[model samples]
Target: MWDDVFPIDQVQEIRTKTTVYLGAGAIKKIYDIAKDLKEKGVDNVLVVTGRSSYKKTGAWDHVEKALKEQGMGYAVYDKVTPNPTADSVDEATKMGKDLGANAVIAIGGGSPIDAAKSVAILLEYKDKTARDLYELSFVPQRAVPLVAINLTHGTGTEVDRFAVVSIPEKEYKPAIAYDCIYPMYSIDDPELMTGLSLDQTKYVSIDALNHVIEACTTKTANPFSILLAKETVRLIAKYLPKAVENPQDLRARYFLLYASMIAGVSFDNGLLHFTHALEHPLSAIKPELAHGLGLAMIVPAVVEAIYPASKDILDEVLEPITKGAEGAEEVAKTLEKWIFSVGVTSKLEDEGFKGEDIPKLVKLVRETPSLDGLVSLAPVEGTDEVIKKIYQRSLKPIA
Candidate 1:
């Protein structure tokens, strides 16, 4: 099926700065990666990850063996939470500095990788805080080398230059994109992703879906972005159900991982708009909210609002899910049904939000530092009213 849709011979690596090794046994290359970094004067390394995924996914066993075999010195900061905060980055940065670490190895998914990117910068800046990076107080020009052992199939952080960190006290979740934050080396092994729960698989795939949707629709979108976006959607549509049914399906996991990597690159080049711009505030306000779930809750309404403007392109990009559905309302309804079929049944109200929360969400979208920039990328004007309506439409499940 993959060959029929996108021939394997044609699926060459889309060149970027990151050196990526992706496949069934890609994690084994970590040993050589560690050796290479050591030769480059990286002595002590800061290993950043979530509390349990590193061990749970069994990625740590391999990583530990590689680092130890290479005689690499390392320290671990495993407290990176979902919707990772700047404080966590600061704490990890302090750990790295104290260890005199010269490189960062990020394990697990987006949160850890995103947090690690900031830690990589802070380690080099020495005097800078995660706050300075997240708040845009400084435009970072360099970072200590980063290596990502990606354990999930979403966020595309391994291949992209973007990192999102939250400042919870200020209710801000802003993303930063710098050429330096791109991982010098990345490993995406489908074998490691089999441990992901059904929800994890669904949400992360949905996150990849949202990445391409916004990428192709953004005003700056180009032919490259659209081509990748279309393939991403098709791959997700074909494999997400199989992976959801059997988490250990390596083939399904492999393609979904491929879809996510491309989606990350797509948005990196084309940028994002409404869904991400709005979902960040949702997760920022409620730290418990999963980033992908927040995206699921709002994306249908975002499609409703943006579809009329980018109808022909979106019709092509969303064809796998929408199935020739015509008009904005029908397309949005079809998308909502597809999201529900994936077992994400929660409305905003189900997730502890109400219509009254719409204004607060809108305010965060406008007031959050980097969010307005994303809003500006929307094909349609992202006015306060337009933002409010998307939130309002999300407050209840589509009936």
Candidate 2:
């Protein structure tokens, strides 16, 4: 079955700066990774994670056991919330500093891993604050070593060099990409993902879908990004529903996890544009909103707007979901129907956003740091008016 989508002959190791340990029981490598880190003078480490998933996913047991066996001191900062904020990053940084941590171990999905990346930066640059990082006030040159034990099949933070954090007071949810933040060692173990809820399974896969959609259509897109983007879409279209139906399906989880990893690498090489640029503000304002849900709400409108400029590439990359749908409007509608079929039926309005919020959302997008950079990569110009129209179209259910 896997050969039909991603051929066996094409399977090859991805050589990146980060060393990835994949497959079932990959978490066991943590013991050796921990020993190696300790040899490099990493006497103490900061463990960043959300409150419950660390133990629920059965990652904490392996991570904790590894640290103990290596005699490595570690501290846990488990208060990372969804849509992690600068405040949380600041708090975690303080904990890492106080613990004299020389390394960071991120043990959750994107939220904790991203937060850990920020914390790692702050730990290295002791004088810099989370505000400085998110605001782009400082260009980070280096960070302490990071080990990511990814428990979710989405975000791909374990392998990517991007970190997003919200500064709610400024209503900014900006992303930072730096070579310094890529995890030195990462684990993608599908066995740790069986505990994900149905909503998590659906939402994370949607996030991967959005990643490739924007990556392939962006101005910097190359043949490499297009190749991975199509495969990412195919894997998600085939496996997401299976994982959603039976959360314990390891095969589905494995493929979905693989889809997300490549999606991360795709965007890392090709970058992203409108959908991610616009969705950050929505989650920034409503901190409770899931990032994937916000992307799902905004992506159809983005596809409709950008399809004219990137018709050929968009049509090819989105083939799995578009299913022969031609033209911009029809392709957008087909994509919307696929999102709905995956149980993400809510519109922006249902998620407590209204048409009146468009101006604020647009303002946040324009004023937020790093966002305009993302918008500029859009195939079509993402003007203020264009941005507003996308938000307006997403306010209600698809007609």
Candidate 3:
């Protein structure tokens, strides 16, 4: 929502002042990239990452020793978490400032990279109130150079000028949008995710599928995003299960990562609709329900609700997803099959959500702005009556 451009050039300015840092299987590319920065007379370096990032990956020691051999000093900051809250970002920023880190090199999934961007923003504007930070009332004039070495590839928060900071304290526990495009560069290597267990790989890929599907079906659906969502769905359908079945499959990993990245880009352009809007509330109200699983639980219900709105688009949308199943009911059946195939059953009840909560959940869905997009796009207007009906519909067994 913020119209601010990311200060990547300014980030480059910082790197020009310090030595470059690199690691996280990105050593080969970072070898070239860091060498390029070093040749430019940059002299200080720092590696931002997690513990297993250094301990298990061997990339850390490799880069550290390489930098040391070249007479460069580097330190690693490797404590961060998933869905990084603003407080965590503040902590990381404080640590970076304490280190006098000239420039930062980060390698990990969206979590660390998103955290790195926040760290840069918070470090530059540490004096601003949290509300101002969210408002972007004060622009960041200076920033630590950040290059993310991407390990897992969902949420191209890598290239986008946006970050989602969870505000667990808010009544709805909404995510604060911090539009700081801080990752100056991104290294997306599928090999890094090759070690992911099938379950891990499948879950993230399904998350991407949720992104694509919701964005595709959103009220703000545009020509370009439609293609992006469809292509991403195609790729994930064909490749996610493959990657999950054989984690070492490089091509499958690449395809799935590419799907997630494109989905990220699409969502960046136009936001996701009902499912995400509803999911965030569920997450705020219930920490036990992971966002991804929350999405899995709701997608089918969204499909059924939005089904009449644009059956043609939904059919086309669901075609590859359904593998060309004929008829609307069959398409729905095919979609349900694939949802379970990827292991997303709408079993929120098993997750401990109760029948009593359905009405409250419907209330939550009815007022949400994200669902506004579904209002026009779906054939029938997304009414509170319909929302309640869908909630009632979802309580039924998936089979």
lDDT of 1 by residue, 1-399 (tens): 543344322213335678888777888888889999989998899999999989987889988988898888899999999999999999999999999999999998999999999999999899888888888999999999999999899899999999999998999999899999999989888888998988889999999999999999999999999999999999999899888888877788889998999998899889999999999999999999999999999999999999989999999999999987989889988999998998988879999999888888899998888999999999999999999999998988765
Q: Is candidate 1 or candidate 3 better by TM-score?
A: 1
Worst 10 residues of 2 by lDDT: 3-12
Candidate 3 TM-score, true structure as reference = 0.78
User: Residue 272 of candidate 3: its Cα lDDT?
Assistant: 68
**By lDDT: ranked, best first:** 1, 2, 3
Q: Model 2: per-residue lDDT, tens digit, 1-399?
A: 643444322223355668888776788889989999989999999999999999987889989999999899999999999999999999999999999999999999999999999999999999999999999999999999999999889897888899999999998999999999999999888889999989889989999999999999898999998999999999999989888888888878888988999999999989999999999998888999999999999899899999999999988888888978988888888899999999998889999998888888888888999999999999998899999989988887555
How close is every model to the real structure, measured as TM-score? 0.97, 0.97, 0.78
| Clash count of each predicted structure | 0, 0, 7
Task: Give a tens-digit lDDT track for model 3, residues 57-109.
Answer: 54555566556655655666677665555566666666766766556676676
Superposed on all Cα atoms, the candidates' RMSDs to the truth, in angstroms, are 2.0, 2.1, 7.5
lDDT agreement with native, every candidate: 0.91, 0.90, 0.61
CA displacement after TM-score superposition, residue 240 of candidate 3 (Å) = 1.3
